[model samples]
Structures are given as C-alpha cells and as structure tokens.
Target: MSDDRFEVVIVGAGPAGAAAALALAREGVEVLVLERGDFPGAKNLFGGILYTSVVNELIPEFWENAPIERHIVNRRWLTLDEDTQIGLDLKSAKFDVPPFNNTFTALRSKWDRWFAEQAEEAGAMVICETNVEELIVEGGTVKGVRTGRDDGDVEADVVILAEGANAMLAERAGFRPQMGPRNRVNAVKEVIALPPEIIEDRFHLEGRQGMALEYFGGAVKGTVGSGFIYTNHDSLSVGVGCLIEEYLRLNMAPYDMLDEFKAHPMIAPLLRGGETVEYATKMIPEDSYDSLSDLYEDGLLLIGDCAGLVNPSIHHEGTNLAMASGVAAAEAVLSARKSNDFSKARLAEYRERLEDSWVMKDLKRYRDTVHFLLENREMVNEYPDLAIRLIRRYFTLDDTPKDDVIKELWKTIRSEVNFLKAARQMWRARKTML
Candidate 1:
C-alpha cells in the first residue's frame, strides 16, 4: 500500500510477469512489476503467434482490444533442401471465424505494452526502466528487491521471478543456475514489411487470416536447429535458431543463417521485395524438463522462461506455459497471503499447482524430445534430401514400374543413413514424440 512495499513483487514485464500482475491486481492484491526495458515490451520478441486461451481467461475476448495482427488459419511444415522443399499445408475454415482460434500473430513490442497496461488498469503498479540489482534476503528468505536507484530497496511479502530466459537476477540470488550453462538456442528474427494484399495473396489467406510456416533441414545449414516464417497483417516474421553448441560448431551467426534462409529458393520468392523494418535476437531454453531451475524457495518463486518452463517438443510452445505458470504463481501467492505464511513450505504449493496444470504435464510428456532430436541431427540434414529424391522419383512419370521406384527410394534412404541407426532414431522419436 506504500511506495516502498507491496504484497507481491514481480520482476520482468513479459507475458508471465504481466499475467501475474494482472491476476493479483484484479483480486485487490498490491502487486508491483519492475521492468528493465524502457517500456514493458521494448525488449521482448517472439517467433509469432500467442496462444491466447490462458490469457483470455484473464481478459475475456482480449483479441478485440489487443494489438493483434492476424489470426492463424493455416499451418505449414516444410522440409527443405538446397533447391527443393517438401511440405504439408493445413488450413481450416473453422479457424477463420468468435473464439476464432487460440493463436494470433502479434508484435511483442505492441502486445506486451498493451498487456502491461491491462495489468496497470487492474491496479498493479508497473515501473519501467528499473533494473533489479539483487534480491534482499534475510535468514535465507526473500524479503525484497534491491535496484540501482537511490533508496531503491523495495519490500514485498513475496517475490516472483518472471524475468525472461536470461534470468540474471535469479541467478545472482542463487535461486537458479546460470542460463549460459544450460542448453540454450540463439534465435534472430526480422519483421519484413509487405502489402497486406500481397501477403494475403502469397499465403492464400483472406481478411485477417494468417499462416505459420516452419522449416527444417537446410534452414539451419544442416545444424541442430530450425527456421520459422509467420504471416503478420502486412509483414512476415522470418528467423533461424540453433543450439549454442551448434552455433559454435558451425561458426555461423544467427542472423547470417536467417539471411541464408531468406534467400533459399523455396523461401526467397515469398519475400521477393519486402522491406525489413524490425529485428530482434532472443535465447530460447531448449532444456525444458531436464534442466528446470529451482522453482520455489522461502518467500520466492520462479515462473516462465526464468524457470525453464518451455516445452521443447515439436510445437515449441513457450508463451502458453509462461502464462499458465504465472497464474499458478499468483494463486499460490494468494493462498499464502490468506494463511499469512510466506515460508518455503507454503510456497511449495506453486510447484504442486503446475504439476496439476498442463504446463508441467506437457513439459513432462515431451521431456525427452529435445535430447532425442538433438542426438539425431541427421534427421534434419540427410532425411530431407532423401525425401526430396524419393518424391522426385515417385512423380517423375517415367516408364518405370511403381514397385521398382519404391525399391530405389528405399535403397537411396539406406545409403544416406545407416538403416539400423535410422531405425533406432525413428523408434526413439516414436517413443518420445508420438
């Protein structure tokens, strides 16, 4: 209730932090969100599309007010070679219409600012341009946060860490391990401006409907990473990302890989003459289930990417998990407040809540996926070329027998990768991903 104290303090104003601030403030809890950026979203970026169900639970029909570009109606998965690509494009009319769909493309800088405003409207005090220097702890319990400004020690009954993927303050407070030591993927994205009509025509869309495309194989220059392209209202988000180890091994810059991806035969045509207006680089935590940081301690909790809550499955769903964990953290904080107990044992309920929510369940289900896929990098590099070769042969309309073509395709696949190794990897994928 005072300038120097609040019932709950959240660091970082990304999705998770904002979600927590909104939920707590709506319930009349004194919550303070500290954002290091000049504004809430000045430093935030995402591939594109926000899974809005969790957020909608907080703000019903949020799309009507949020700065959304388009609602996704099509999903494309492409396997590419140097000069060729094979893809599956799925589109549905069901996604074009109230409750249109759960996903929408948004510019984070715009979306996050609006989201923080929502929190502010609900009575949360959000202070931007303030970097938390350290957590004030007493007797191993978090008491408040220390910032750079004079007399900047602000007190709080509980501190929630939603400070994005880098989690510097959490690491400094010894709440989690250094993010640099964990498995991280470096990604770079650029927003290319295009005409709205051109975007709709090129992607086969109509009236605010959008498409999301993901690329494998040559996208990462055959490294253990992937690339993505998403259609905004009048722009395209194109980026490439790879594991830190792969980046070092390949000696490739994330932006350089993105440039190469943009120029690919199958990709270049899509962005023929678009002008790029925005660029961002981010670090995604690929070690979701295995290397999750400590989630809670006395009077403190961690949520979102700070806790390594990313789902490293094929979907790469991070924002949904972030919002879900934020809600769970807020609920736990409310419970602790009701009991007037902010000890470690009381805060442990946050983990229990996540375990019961889809955030932990989904992460647990695909826990082995990242490791499995990383170990099988050949699937990203060799198999796409093999697939292209087989597809080319299959539809060549030659005078050869269909059975003979099948035999040749099988032979070609075996020659590129050891049959046993491929089979083993396939089996592991089935066991882990399917």
Candidate 2:
C-alpha cells in the first residue's frame, strides 16, 4: 500500500466521523480521518442540546470525562406574542440522576475536539487543517479523496463522507441533489457569558443541573421557525432559526431577527446583563425522510448532516442521529472488510442498519411535519396570539360577572376563528405533529 493509503478514509471530524473512527479503530482497522477545520467543531454550531444515548453506547459513562456543560432537568415549551408568553413547563427530579434522561448541553467546539481525541487514543490518525476537494473516482467507483494540498490523493478501500450541511463534496460527487431553500434552515446562535451564580439564579438551576427553553410563535416574529435558550454552566446558548425560504419571503436577515428576539419584552429579562462570548451561524439540512439522499454508493457512504439525518420535529434531534449513523457506518465497514468486498452492495448493510434503528424510524414517523407546518402558517402566526389573548382575559380581574366573561370569551373565539377549519387543522396536527 502507498504511504497515504488506509483501510478506510473518513472525511470531517464531527460527531459522525469521530464515532466512525472510534469504532473502526477499536476493531484495529487502519483508518484515517481528514478534517478541514483547524480542529473538529471549530466551525460547527447547533442549538446546544446533546442527546447522549448514542454517546453512551460508544463510550460508556461518557459524561464523567466528556466536556459536558450541564445535565438538563427542566424543559419548557413556550409560545410568545408581542408582549405575552404562555406554555408548558416541566421540571423533574427524575432527570437530575445519572444518565440524566440522556440529555445534556455542550459546546461543539469543546465536545467535537474531545471526541476526536478519543478516536486518536484508539489509534485512528486524524489530520486537521486539510480540506478534501473531491472524491477520486475510477471506473465508476470511489477510490479515495483528493485534498487541496500537493500530493493530497489518499487511497482507501472505502470512503465515508460526514461533511456537514453545505455538502459541496457530496454535490460535486453527484451523491445527492442540491438542497433547495425549503430543505434548509439558517440558524444563528450566541454564547452569552455570565457568572455561574447568576446563571443558576436566572434559570432556576442548581449545581450542574440546567434548563432548556424553546420559544415559538412571535419569538421569530411569527415566522416558520423557533428560538431557544439553553443554560450552560456559566453561559447561555441563545439562538433562533427559520426556513431559508421564509427569510427570503420576509426579506429579512438572520442577525436582525436574532436582535429582535433578544429585545423581546419576555426574552430580555433573562439576558439582561450578559456578555456575548461567541457567535456562529450555520445551515442545517432539514430534509424529510421522503427526500433524504441515498446513503451509499460504490465504495462510499454518507452520514450525519450529509445524509440529511436530522429529525426536524419538535424533538429537534440531530447529533444523536448523526452519531448513530456513524456507528452504523463503522459496523457496515467492518462487516465488509471481513469479506474483502468494498462494493456498493456490501455497503447496503449501512442503510439496513439505520432502517432497523430509531434513527430512521423516528425520521419516517415525522416525515410530514415540516411540510404540514409550512402549509399551515396560521399555526405559528395566528394561533399563539389567539391563545395568549384568551389566557390573559381569563386571568384579568374585571367587574363583569362570571357568566358574562364566559360569553365574551366565546364571542371572541367565534369572531376570530373558523371552527370547521380549526377542527381540520387540529386533526391533521394529531397525525403529523403529535
């Protein structure tokens, strides 16, 4: 074999690539990982929730040594109007225990670099600051990858692409179609720094326990998106994201939307005196299960965001699914190596494994959610405002009698809502969202 050749060459060192490398290295496979960033996670961004069930399967009790910010004990779902907020709040002592409901918050820059180090410790060679330009194809099969550096062609029996949402390499290689604006979401986040005590007091957290709050409706100015605030140890990860198509329709910028979200009367008090420590923006692949790209080709596989593995439902799960796909890819590669066949047929096992796991099942179940929400813009734009007004009227002290108050509320509902249309929308939500 040439000096640059390996048993497997994996691109990008995010959760998916790192998990693949770790699993392969543990089995004594000669694997090389190429990372474009100065290090893994340097350019990665997410909404700050890390569902750790997949991580536990990869490295048992990972939170003990991982760079985790906090274990979430409180989860709140809020809907906002211009001046009012109302929703459900659930806080449980059950989530404060070990395993912590498999939920935690982490900064990707710290988490990704640390995860790649685990692969390195397991004997995988991870090279950073090297950009993979394209796949080296021969006779209709992938042979390796061509990097930007001189003599940068690296050979492998098989290659895995964990490149993120932009997926230039996947597009160039004809592995997938170009993602449309409807299939993409542009997210912006800022890590706001504050004293640990202040953070705990503000968010009602104790010790390493944390809170995750999700905002909808007027949070994004009634756009088809959501806002989030996750409590880290001494910082808050505050962000908002929406469909790129919505941004174009509204003729608005993401940063400007973020500023408006921060200035909201209901949102400002929580972040009254914080310093911005880090800000980032990235595009997330939100393709539905029906539109997901093909997972494998001749001697090649795609995982993570490159495969459009994000579950864009209310759960907002991506990292866990990405890591799960990585492990499946590694298992498929190991099985293929035993037979010394790295053909497209052999890599079919990767897709089969994903289909058998929760990764694909959850995605398939929520296949219609994004489209359903998009079609019913009133769900975000009008419903929340209507709900808040009704709740506020119910709570306000007035001179009207109880019977009169009930009559007034019914009148308002009748005037503002079409009962038949609402019933149909609610029934559709039961199938698509619930």
Candidate 3:
C-alpha cells in the first residue's frame, strides 16, 4: 500500500471504529482509523456502563486487562417524584464472577484510548487529532476520505463511518439523511469523585463490585428522557438525558436537568461531599429501526451511532451494539477483500451480519418504544407521581382502617385516571416495550 492509501479507512476512533480496526488488523488487513479528538475517547461520553460481551469476543477475558473500573453486580430502576422514589433493586452474586455478566463501568477517556491502542498494536494505523473533512466520492462511489491535514486525501478500498451520533461526514456525503431533534438525545454527565469506602458503603457494594441506577419520571422533569448514576471505584458517573426534541419543546437545558438530578433529595445524599472531577456532554442517536438510514452503499458502510444502532428502550444499550456493528463491518470488509470487490452488493454482508446478530434484533424489538413514550407522555409524566402518592398513602400509619385506605386509593385512581384508557396504554406499552 502507498502512503496515501489503505485497504480500509475508518472515521472516528470510538468503540465501533476501534473494534473494526482491531478486527481487520488482526486478520492482516491494512486498516487506517482517523480520530478527531486529541485521542480516542477524549470527546466521548456515556452513562458509564460498558457491555463487554462484544469486547470479550474480540479479546477473550478483556476485563482481566482492560481499564475497567468496576463490575456491575447490582442494577436498580427507580421512578422519582419531587421528594419520593420507588425502586426495584436486583443483585446477583453470579454477576460478580468471571464474565461479570458482561457489564462493567469504565471512564470513556481512559477506555477509548486503551481500545485504540489495541487496534494499533494489532497493525492498524490510528491517526489522532485528524478530522475527516469529507468522503472522496467519484461517480457516486466512495473512494477514500479527505482529512484536515496536509496531503489529506487518503484513498482506501472501503470506508467505514463510525463518526458518533453527529455523523457530519455521513450527512455531508449524503449516506444518510440529517437526523432531526426527535431522533437524537442530548446528555450531560459529571464524574463526581468520592472516597472508595464511602462509595462502597453508600451503594452497598463490596470490593470492586458496582451498582448502576436508572431514574425515570421526575428525573428529567418529566421529559422523555432518563437519569443514570453508576458507581465507580472512587467516583460516580451521574447524568441525565432526554430527547433533543423534548429539550426544545419544553425549553429545557441538559445541564440544568443534570443539576436537578444531582440535587434531587434521593440523589443528593448519594453524591454528598463529592467533588466534580470531570464533566462532558454528548449526543446519541435514538432512531427507530424502521427509520434507520441505509447501512451500506458502494465502497462504504456506516456503523455505530452513525447508523442509528442504539436500542433506546429500557435496556439502554449503545456501546455494545456499536462494537458489534464494528465487528460485523470488519467481517463484511474481509469478505469483500477476498473477492477484491468493494461494491454495494459486496458490502451488503455488513447489514446481513448485523441483522443476524443481537444488535439489530434488539433494536427491532424496541423500535416503537421511543415513539410510544413520546406520544404517550402521561406514562412518564403523570404515572410515576400517581404511583408514588398511592404507595406513600398505603404505607402511611394513619388511624383509618386498611379497607378504607384501599377504597380511598381506588377512588383517587378513578377520579384522576380513566381506567379504560390507562389499561389501553398499559397494553400498548407492553407491546411496544416488552
């Protein structure tokens, strides 16, 4: 290969790009990965959970050597009101063992760089701080990419677009349509430093075990979003995110929501006395599978957020899907290489691989969830408060008879909500989300 050419070029060095580079490089494919950040993960942010099943496939027993902070053995889901919360917490000792249930908490800034290094060590040429200006397209075929550097036009047999949610290059190249606000989520996060002992005590964790907590309803001021807090070794990743369209429609700011989340009565005590060590913001693609953009074209494939691979359901999965898409992209490229074919038909294998994997299956399963929640805002906005009120009333030590309390609760429910409509909504929720 020449200095200005490679067999495959990947834009963005996040999990997807790095995974693809590593896989292709391991197979002796000449892959080049370009990253716009000062280094990989410098500009990436997530809720702190790294689902490592895909990583384990790439590097068996990755948790043994990766810069993993903690293995999550406890998961909690909470519904919040102004000053009250109802929660369900699940803990499993099995998750604390070897595979750790494939869930771990990691700081992206540290993890991304480490992952890219693995790709580099495997023979992929990773160039950081080099922004891909655009794709070099000729006769509707992607030839390579043009970067911001001198002699920037580097040619490649195929180009993989893993450029995060913004997908500027993909948009510019018309590989996908410009994503609207409703199809995206804006999030802000803070890494709050605390004593390790305090973290363990407060979260009921032992050793390197961690807990992941997700909040809905008042968490984002009843917006179509959620808040998350993940326990790290000596810090907490706290953040809130909602639909970009919700942010605009409600005239709200992500930072303000994050502040509110941190200040919530139930949330504040956990983060008390902690110092903020890092703050970052990110955009996530929440597009439904039915609305997903074209995955492949001649000489090109889009993976990760750029391809809208996010599963925006209760699962809250993104990184794992991104890495899986990366591996699939690499497989497709390798297949095409065997025939020296870089046409759209040859690259269709990328989509087929993803369709055959859990990545696409989960996305398809919850394709209607985001839209359903958006349309039925009452499920998130009103139901949590109502449930909390009823539960609080039930647990209150009042002089009234228990039967009277149950009757009163039923009366309140009848007065406040239409039973038929509520039942219908619940059925729809089950169909859309379950």
TM-score of model 3 vs. true structure: 0.98
Q: Write the per-residue lDDT of candidate 3 for residues 121-163, one digit (tens) a residue.
A: 9999998899988898999999999899987899999999999
Looking at model 3, the pairs that clash are none
Q: For model 3, what is the alpha-carbon lDDT of residue 78?
A: 96
By how many angstroms RMSD does model 3 differ from the true structure? Answer: 1.2
Which 10 successive residues of model 2 have the least lDDT summed? 1-10
Better of 1 and 3 by TM-score: 3
Segments in model 3 whose C-alpha atoms lie over 4 Å from true places: 1-3
lDDT score, residue 200, model 2? 91
Query: For model 1, what is the alpha-carbon lDDT of residue 291?
Result: 67
Name the TM-score of candidate 2.
0.98
Q: Where does candidate 1 stray beyond 4 Å?
A: 1-3
Estimate TM-scores for all models.
0.96, 0.98, 0.98
